[model samples]
Target: MFKTNETQMQIHSIRWLKVIDPDQEYITHISTQFSIPRNFIQTALDENASARIQCKQQATLIMTHLPFNTSSKAEQSVSCKSFAVIIKDHLVFIISKHDHPIFDQMIQYVEQGPEHSAEQLADYVYRFLELAADQFIVASKSVNEQISTVEHELLSSIKNKQVFKLLNHNKVLNRIAISLRGNSKVLNLLNDMQVVTGHQAAQHRLLNVMVETDQAQAMAEIHNINLSNLMDAYSAAIENNLSLLVQYLSVYVIIAAIPLGIASLYGMNIPLPLQEQPYALSLLAGLSLLLSVAIVIIFKKRQII
Candidate 1:
């Protein structure tokens, strides 16, 4: 059954005895039933509890991180909040600070079981954690695809179309990294729990999940690094292109200035060497053509054109 506290799902579980408050009566009841210390129960019930594994006189009390979706930005962040307690063969409890879709789904599956065993209960918890890992994998894959798309666009000739996409890709990568780190912590906690319980199969499964997650994280990191490098290379290429363009324009400017300078000098209306010669205009034109050809030859020789 689901309980509400301030409009948030207070507790979710299948065959577990859930206690929201560690008050006098609640503590006394759990203590009597489980032969456990009231202090241990109280500590477990603390909302500000840390992830830990504690052994009581009667049961093994474990507090582990459970994944939750708590992102407020375009990129979603994964968060972990305390979830369950396994008190011996008779009792299991799940508590949450808020509604969790993963735990809720586990509850539904457990309810469908005709009878429950301690092994089944443990397996259910493991399955919930595995499912959480699966979600992370899904999110990582989605982000990776997005990065690939953005990288392709950035590499193409359409700079205007790719700029916004690249920015969004970076944002997504950052968010995914945050979520991956969080999920990794939870996965480690789960693996540690399995080790403590001596559940070899669960440990193997958890390790596999961790491996998959690490691969995804690595892919995201590599893509981010590659994209940054590509951007730097593109910027350098653009700078080189601009330098070549400036050099070409400078040569043209010098060539064009020669004609202007000659006209300006002749416009003084003073006597000049070829002012009244019969073939002066033709000779001047011919000299100008030769000079232009010489400039072209110089540029070609220097490999500047």
Candidate 2:
């Protein structure tokens, strides 16, 4: 039931099976054809699956989350998807829900020819891990740019939408961080298992994979910290702005009450100061204006306005 686009390659007498976005029927076929434990395959294809390695008598399964889609469109958020590689004797199966570009590179690597060994197979796995780490790095950079854009917008003027965008960006960064940590754990487990044993070159490549994974993890953490701080500062700023607004409104209310009080007194039928003066209304108006101006000037001098 495999599609034509799916590939099964024979390299140096070793069979390589690569499936892309397999369905239930395809999974059934793979399970029946290869006798692989169904859970091994399912775990790899599960969207929310974390990085893991499971060893059984029949097969060794290595699964890690990779950047699923890295479209540069501003509206699209970064995400990771599971990619699993299973090795049983001379047979290797690579499974993923999305046909990542790294798979293409692996196909080329397979075609280029190399002596097949556990190290070579491990190297194949390493390539998947390496590419995942690299993708995380790219995602971190993209997120940093987005943070900058949001910060710039905030600097010019604060808006509710921009704050919401900050929250969204932080969420993306947290996802990346969590995925990187999972991948790092898997890579460390692989190193401890010595899957590439006795091959110095492969071991070195594995070390690079570990280093890259750690670096990506570190970047994600740093971004998360910076984003957290930014959000805290933004919240503080919003509070400060609100406080200032309330202060200004209070000041204006007090200033307006002066005129209202004067008007109320003049409207009363009871005798008031200077009521019989011909220019009493004009005089009262001038008094209200002078008092309002004085109060405003006092607020300004006290740095309250």
Candidate 3:
């Protein structure tokens, strides 16, 4: 079930309030009790969320990005957006325009058992953040595998047939890079929140998340650079092959032109000095054969054949 902040609070237990708007009467009532700023509540309710931790005169404001799957592809990476304002001991408010699996799971947990403590709520938040980070690492590995496959195809056998596939891989890599960057920002915010909240355990966990994200980002960048270089190398190789083809064609043209030149001269109607000599045709044939042989030898010696 999707968790919306309109649920009523249970007796004295840590409340899981999901509100669509900070201006709602229910939200205002809680704000008064929790001493949370109306402005912070409003920002939390907005659809576009940023990673931030602000300590107002009233309560701590925590905004975090949660992962959600939007694609039908089996291996697709989930998209994420900010879910904000985890007010202290009393309320854990989250606002999101879309459904998230982890958030949904949390809601189920809450519904089945509504006895979650404040520390448990905080732990849940940290767990969700870690899950999101883990997803980033998983997505990175998928992208890396695709890159490896494409690179092998590009290097082992250069073919126009696979160009479209390579382009698609490039597009996927770009999307993964963008997601990684966003996840990195979220990790940084989590790290900062851990510091502000003095949650040493959360801080340590987030540090590991940060390290994994950085490693994934680095791998992505390297793969991208390698793909680009391979494309360039393929282009150069193709161009060199075309140049060699042209040179071979040029050599054939020169060889054929030699016989054509001899024919043209003999075709002239004017009586030439060798025309009257017996065996002149044989002599011309011998000379033409010698010239062809010489050309072949010269080309072979120059390594142009």
Candidate 2 structure quality by residue, lDDT tens digits, 1-305: 54424677786756777888777777888888888888887887787887888987668888888776555666757777788888887788888877777777776677675666545766665765677688889888988898898887775453567778889888888888888889888888888986444366667878999999889889988998999999889877766776777898899999999999999888999988899999988999999999999999999899998
Model 3 residue runs over 4 Å out of place are 1-12, 15-50, 55-61, 64-85, 105-115, 152-203, 234-305
lDDT of each: 0.60, 0.80, 0.63
Order candidates by TM-score, high to low.
Answer: 2, 3, 1
Model 1 global lDDT (CA atoms, 0 to 1): 0.60
Kindly list the per-residue Cα lDDT of model 1 for residues 1-305, writing each as its tens digit: 43332111212332454455444665576678667766666665554456566666756665654445556665444443554455564455554445556655666666766545544555655565566556656655665576566565445342444545555555566555555565566667756655234255545666777786677667667766766666666555556666777898999988877766776776787899888899977877777777887988988998978
lDDT per residue (tens digit) for residues 1-305 in model 3: 33334544443456765554434665677678777787677667655566667777646676655444455564444354566746665566655555455555655566665346554555555555566666656655665676566556655353454455555556655655665676677668756555334355645766776787777667767766776776677666656666777899999988877877887898899977688879888887778878988998999999999
Worst 10 residues of 2 by lDDT: 1-10
Task: Report the number of the highest-lDDT candidate.
Answer: 2
Give the least accurate 10-residue stretch of model 1, judged by summed lDDT: 5-14
Q: For candidate 3, what is the TM-score?
A: 0.54
Ranking by lDDT: 2, 3, 1
**lDDT-superior candidate, 1 or 3:** 3
Specify the highest-TM-score model's number: 2
**What TM-score does candidate 2 get on C-alpha atoms?**
0.79
Against the true structure, what is each candidate's TM-score? 0.49, 0.79, 0.54
